[model samples]
Target: MKNKGVVFTTQAAMIAAIYVVLTVVFAPFSFGSVQVRIAEALTILPAFTPAAIPGLFVGCLIGNILGGAMLPDIIFGTLATLIGAVFTYILRNQNKFLAPLPPIVANTVIIPYVLRFAYGEAIPIPLLMLSIGIGEVISCGVLGMILYFTLNKYKHRLFAL
Candidate 1:
């Protein structure tokens, strides 16, 4: 039992660290209204492990702060990731292909507002939505799906906790 908890904590911490690295390393494409945060691909991990819920949230929070996001972006953007991770965990039993949908939708719906109101972007809200949505689709849908498929093949070995 103690080992299980340790494994879960370790997994979550590792995931969070990986997310921060990906976000910081890809800073150019990880921020701004027209951005594709490659770290979002990790959002799909919730479908395999519940620890990812908080992992992604904390990761996004730190990533946002380190990325020089405004206050609202840090708050709301982290919430968006948390919500998506929870939903993904809830839907874990469904089709593997659906694992990325929650993050895609959550970020698509929440980030544009963060951009317009938080960052005071001059771009119209609808256009921001379009751009953010496109970025989410690429990060969560395309890249996440690729990750999902690859990890699915080694779930037992990689996520055995």
Candidate 2:
């Protein structure tokens, strides 16, 4: 039991670290009105284990801070990731194809407002939503799905929570 706890903590920490690294490494596209945030690809982690929920939340918070995002972004953006992760975990047992839907929808719905209000971008709301949705589609929908398939094969061993 104690060992299981340790493993859980370790996995969460590792996921957080990876999220931060991926966000920072891809800093150029990780933030801004028009962004893809490849680190979002990790948002699918929750489908594997609940630990990924906090892992992704903390990672997004830190990534926002390190990426120098505005206040609303730091708070609300992290919230978006948290919301997405929670939903992803809840829907984890559903079709594997649907695993990324939560994060994609959460970010698509939330990020446009963040970009407009937080960063004071002058884009139209609908346009902002479209751009943000496109990014989410690429990051969480496309890339995240690819990641899901890759991890699915090794999930039993790699994420044995």
| TM-score on alpha carbons, each prediction | 0.97, 0.97
Per-candidate local distance difference test: 0.92, 0.90
Q: Which ranges in model 1 have alpha carbons more than 4 Å from their true place? A: none
Name the regions of candidate 2 deviating beyond 4 angstroms. Answer: none
RMSD of 1: 1.1
For candidate 2, report its TM-score: 0.97
What is the Å distance of residue 142 in model 2 from its true position? Answer: 1.1
Model 1, residue 13: displacement in angstroms? 0.2
Query: Per-residue lDDT for 48-97 in model 2, tens only?
Result: 98889989998999989999988999999999999999999999999988
lDDT of 1 by residue, 1-161 (tens): 44988888988999999999999999999999889999999999999898888889889999999999999999999999999999999999998888888988899889989888887899988888889989999999999999999998999988887
